[model samples]
Target: MASSAFSAAKIVGLTGAAWLSGTIAAISLISIPAVSRTLKEDNLSAAHAVKLWRNNFEAGFALAPPIALATASSLASCGWAARNLRTSGVKDGRLFWVAAALTVSIVPYTIIFMKSTNDKLLRYAKKEKLTTSESQETEGLLKRWVFLNSVRSLLPLAGALLTSIVVLA
Candidate 1:
């Protein structure tokens, strides 16, 4: 039963990590660029871009915590189990530890690097009127946010890939 439970948790963690990575990739590769192009067109489009950004931000924020928790929990549990089993060589747990670190690091990464921009974007979104300068400023912020987000997206992808390799090995 314990083994089964571990397997189940590993599956859950892998799935969550994959989903999170994919979402981040989509946001970085597709959504941000699309919205940015819209922003360049006109004020109405800028407002629409803001709306889309807000929705994407909220959805990502909502999903990240739970996925991080599950990934961390499963990785930790697996790591502990692997240690107890006295597996040979450093690679036995090395990948899992790296995966776990990357998985949990997303929290601090988001808080430290992404939160201020997220807050500013949220504030900008709430504004009733934005001058051309303000719109340009917001676009600049969005560009920074997208770049930071792209970096963040890589963490989970690497983590997930490492974790999968660990499991397969």
Candidate 2:
């Protein structure tokens, strides 16, 4: 039963990490660029688009903590199991720890780098009217947000890669 649980945890961890990496990639590569173009056309359109995007982002963000926790928990479990079994050949425990650390780092990264821009965008999206300066500022913020968000994506991708290597090894 414990073995089965460990296996399930590993599967869930890998799945969550992969899903997060893909989602971040899509947002960075596809969604942000597409939305940025749309945002440039008109303020009303930009407001609506941002609102929709924020809603989607919030939904995804809400799920991230649980997924990250699960991934970290699973990696820790694998390490513990390996150590208990005296698996001398499995140096992958360090890889698991690295992956878990990366997974856990996402929260602080988001808070430190992404939160201010996200808050500003959300506030701007709520406005009934946007002046030219406001629109330009929004555009600037969006560009910065996209760049920072791309950086954010890399953390999970690295975590996923590390986790994959550990699992496969």
Candidate 3:
């Protein structure tokens, strides 16, 4: 059935997108702090710091496209799901199960922010003790990662909902 195809495709697409985004977030958790510490450890002049920062920005930009693709898939999935839901007499069980799966998938995206959030809250823990240059750099890197990751998660969900509205109309 065409409707069933749409539902199945949506689930598949969302699953793929969630996994892809989660993987990227995991990698960033590992890499952001390392890169930040490395940058600070160089102890370069201000000009060199500027250069390094620019390079890092460029690298992040380069990584953005695949992330975009992952999000796009979610958007598409949302549209598919919404379209399927528009029809009357659909089984509530199917819809409920899909919703449950989506809710579960969201856990990782939410928790991925935990480290950055914890770091922010724990700033008090280290306030009395002066953090090293490397520590400060790591914090900065973690901040950027959080910002980007937040954007990554929010935008896709927005796009998906937008698509659903547009398509369902």
TM per candidate comes to 0.87, 0.85, 0.39
Check candidate 3 and list the clashing pairs: none
- Report the C-alpha displacement of residue 135, candidate 2, in angstroms: 0.7
lDDT of 1 by residue, 99-161 (tens): 877887878898999999988888878877667777767788889989999889888778888
lDDT tens digits, residues 55-147, model 3?
543454465455545445444455445545656233232333343333334345445754455344344233433345644554554556556
List residue ranges in candidate 2 displaced over 4 A: 41-44, 86-92
Q: Which ten residues in a row have the lowest lDDT in candidate 1?
A: 82-91
Any residue pairs clashing in model 1, and if so which?
none
Please provide, for model 2 over 1-169, each residue's C-alpha lDDT reduced to its tens digit, 9 standing for 90 to 100.
Answer: 2666656666666777777767776776888777777766553465666676677578768877777777777777766665544433455467767777787677899899889888988887788766667766876877888788778777767878887776677
Q: Alpha carbon lDDT of residue 2, candidate 3?
A: 60
Which residue pairs show collisions in model 2?
Answer: none
C-alpha lDDT score of every prediction, in listed order: 0.77, 0.72, 0.46
Regions of candidate 1 where Cα sits further than 4 Å from its true position: 42-45, 86-91
Query: How much is 40 displaced in model 2, in angstroms?
Result: 3.1
